[model samples]
Target: MMISALPPGLPHPPQETERLKSAAEQLETSFLAQMLKSAGVGEMPEGFGGGIGEEQFASFLRREQAREMAQVGGIGLAQSLFEAMRERHDV
Candidate 1:
């Protein structure tokens, strides 16, 4: 099998916050934001997964937003922000 090389400075997965941030910035991708949205992953109430009765989910989002903001000096936008850093940097 032939090996395929990746682009310079682009790891399969980010290895640090700075790297991830830089990649997102350079590629105009919102990986961090998308990841943040995914981490709040949870199933909605039965029969309401795709229904209009997502009040509980909405409430959860609100609380999560407040917590994130408070943690990041009002700039924390998503749990993924912190989670990504922790994962990439092991910090």
Candidate 2:
């Protein structure tokens, strides 16, 4: 997360914009993960499924999937969020 100041003639550093985009994407990922949870995305069926370990780790799997989805242009939420935040970033 180190952001060094750009040399004299250079415009705003791309790093800051990249950081903001990453943050927005992560936010989208979290939102998708929550929605998936509410939709029983990773829910194990029956009482004798993969046991407690599977239950505990299913969330991690769902979140990873959500992150990948966001990275691959999912639902357009991340892009919209990034554009709005970028306005504030340039302010």
Candidate 3:
């Protein structure tokens, strides 16, 4: 959530722009996490420490992984979202 300072004389984005960017990134993360979950990327194999607890917490791991992936430019969804919002808002 650390936004870099805009260069001097550049117009700063409104507060709503920051909120939109954050929301867009979060949406992308959620989408990616769900996709990873659907693909069973982190499911523990049977008899390999797999259990109800693991199952219960699998989504959490997937979410964290997805967040990292998004941060590292996974699928470019966040960038696309940000660009689209910027255009829509003329910011």
The model with the greatest lDDT is 2
- Provide C-alpha RMSD values for all models, in order: 10.7, 3.9, 6.0
Cα lDDT over the full model 3: 0.81
Residue-wise lDDT of candidate 2 within 1-91, one digit each (tens)?
5345456444566777788789999999999999888989988888759988997799999999899999999799999999887665455
Residue-level lDDT tens digits of model 1 in 1-91: 5334455455455444555554434222233334445665444666657654474665556556544544444444334455464455432
- State each model's CA lDDT, in order: 0.47, 0.84, 0.81
Listed in order, each prediction's TM-score against the native is 0.25, 0.80, 0.72
Residue range with the least summed lDDT across 10 consecutive positions in model 3: 2-11
Worst 10 residues of 1 by lDDT: 24-33
Cα lDDT, model 2, residue 65? 86
lDDT of 2: 0.84
Question: Model 3 compared with the native: what TM-score?
Answer: 0.72
CA lDDT of 53 in candidate 1? 49
Give the clashing residue pairs of candidate 1, or none: none
